[model samples]
Target: MLIFLSLYFLNDIFAFSGSQDLCGYCFDTLVNSFDKRNSILSPSFKNEQHPIFVTWKKKGQLRGCIGTFSPLPLHSGLQEYALISAKRDDRFRPISVSEVPDLDVTVSIMHSFEQASRWDDWKVGVHGIRVSLNDGTSIYSATYLPEVMSELGWNQEQAIESCLQKGGYRGKLNDRIKAQVQVTRYQTSISKMDYQEYIQWRKAKLTSIRGDL
Candidate 1:
């Protein structure tokens, strides 16, 4: 039977939400260098859509952190950002496959985004902040995830200033600049994966495949 169906309908049939074990998918992505857009992921990992940040670290030092504010299917979002953070983050050189053995990947699922009533309206350790400023000619914007402030031991003011600097602002960051910026705060749910975790996940997958065969 031939029937016409809307993309939205297909999306509704596919999209899902809630707790997920994402380590396996990420491990497969790295091992096979697979594109998530074309890869098969567990339905549990693709049920809901959200804005996501993919962070990579080695020895507790930041290797890369990149994400989108725009919501996307969780599977595609994680896969796209995983590769992007590992290879395309301008602040650091691309992470090689050799480095993958020691890399730790953290996936932050963003939600509850709301505009701040004031620059300091959000909590320092509980909310991620995104700030934008216009100097009448150009607009500059940047974001710091919630963990950034607590990890760096920064107060709200310091975090805001650092975000401004990240936005490529060269001028002094004062109350005036802070006043002119629009601030948005958000919260996230985080999942982390280490090399050992990836290995265990891979072994399980291989076992499953062998049993199926």
Candidate 2:
């Protein structure tokens, strides 16, 4: 069975709809099916905004990460982006199907992109950041959580460097599209379950939860 994306990033994508009280378990089946994803792109609330970053991990080691600095079209919503981060990031090796069983996915929901008006607002942990320069290009990076700074032991320079390196920032500062950004980052995680097992589990859960009797 392909334990590919089952239960990955469920918590991060669904947290804002708290009153709905949706759990990650449920999200495994009930995806954020909105094709024109409002939250991940141009969010309805101030907290949700464009150019967000996503990172994935399995058994506490880095797996994958990908995001945008400028607002990507909502058509490329979280579902697609999450999958891209999983199988496509070049940082580490591609996540093998074997690593699926022990994996866990964590996601960071970043705040609105703000130009670096004041460098002080940029805290390594508390901020999910984007850094860019003059041409028409930009960078994007986010952590699994605000605590990642302490856990990773990174300072601002390291964080900035990371955003630059990992997020595909190319060329000199005076070149490309120049822009400095910061975000109030929030995060969430979901236990990675077997993809086939999750599918079966969901069929059972839905039948039991949304019972006809």
What clash pairs does model 1 have?
Answer: 16-47, 16-48, 17-47
| Model 2 misplaced stretches (Cα beyond 4 Å) | 1-52, 69-76, 134-148, 165-204, 207-210
Model 2 alpha-carbon miss at residue 3, Å: 38
Which candidate leads the pack in TM-score? 1
* RMSD values, in order shown: 7.0, 10.8
lDDT against the true structure, per candidate, is: 0.73, 0.44
The alpha-carbon root-mean-square deviation between model 1 and the true structure, to one decimal in Å, is: 7.0
> Over the full model, what C-alpha lDDT does candidate 2 score relative to the true structure?
0.44
Per-residue lDDT of model 1, residues 1-213, tens digit only: 001222222334223222225645655566557344434434345445567788889889999999987767767777788778888999999887788778888777766667888899999889999888898888889999998889999999888888988998777878788789888887667777788887776666667768987
Which stretches of candidate 1 lie above 4 Å from their native place? 1-20, 34-43, 208-213
Report the lDDT of model 2 for residue 207. Answer: 68
lDDT of 2 by residue, 86-133 (tens): 767766776665665555444343433334453335666455444433
What value does the lDDT take at residue 180 in candidate 2?
41
